[model samples]
Target: MDFNENFVLGCSAIGAGLAVIAGIGPGVGQGIAAGHGAAAVGRNPGARSEIMSTMLLGQAVAETTGLYGLLVAMLLLFVKPLVG
Candidate 1:
């Protein structure tokens, strides 16, 4: 590969890696949320349904960040927008 091609590939790889790093935040956040949800459920069994629904909704929203990262990494790898 020419220098330009190599450079593009390198940059794409780096960007994809950086994009994937976004997953860590969601992962940690989800874990913390789950822990709190479990604690809440334990403290108030009567409100389990409400707590579960709210937890699920918040987790789903948080999960979107990881999904966005995945999409960005996939685009960088497969779309190759930087290349001619």
Candidate 2:
């Protein structure tokens, strides 16, 4: 369309790319949490239920970051707020 529109679209694409990077943190965090949880359960088999529940909860919380990143990327690509 116009120069400003083109610039906004380009910037939005870059920003969306950056936003998707947020998924990395949650992936790492969840992996570490799962590893630690498994270790903890191995150390104390009797506490397996507690460890599992806590690990699942923590993983769910950590997953929100990735979900947020996806949402942001979707909005940036589809909404085109700045371009408008």
Candidate 3:
């Protein structure tokens, strides 16, 4: 490939790497949320519905960050925004 093409690919790879880094926050947050949810369930099994609903809602919201990261990575890898 040409020097410019190689440079763009390298930059895209770096951008994808940086984009994927965003997933860490959602991952850690989801894990903490899940742990707390499990603990809440253990403490009060009767409120399972409420606890589950709230946990799922929070997890889904938190997961958006990871989704955005994945989207950015995918765009970098596949969409080839820097190609043109």
- List of clashing residue pairs for candidate 1: none
Model 2 has a clash total of 0
1-84: candidate 3 lDDT, tens digit per residue: 545787898899899999999989998999999999999999999999999999999999999989999999999999888976
Model 3 lowest lDDT segment of ten: 1-10
What is candidate 1's lDDT per residue for 1-84, written digit by digit as tens? 555787888899899999999999999999999999999999999999999999999999999999999999999999988877
Clashing pairs in 3: none
In order, the Cα lDDT scores of the candidates are 0.93, 0.94, 0.94
TM-score of every prediction relative to native: 0.86, 0.80, 0.88
Residue 52 alpha-carbon offset, candidate 1, angstroms? 1.0
Pairs with steric clashes in candidate 2: none
Model 2: per-residue Cα lDDT at residue 29:
98
* Model 2 Cα shift for residue 59 (angstroms): 1.4
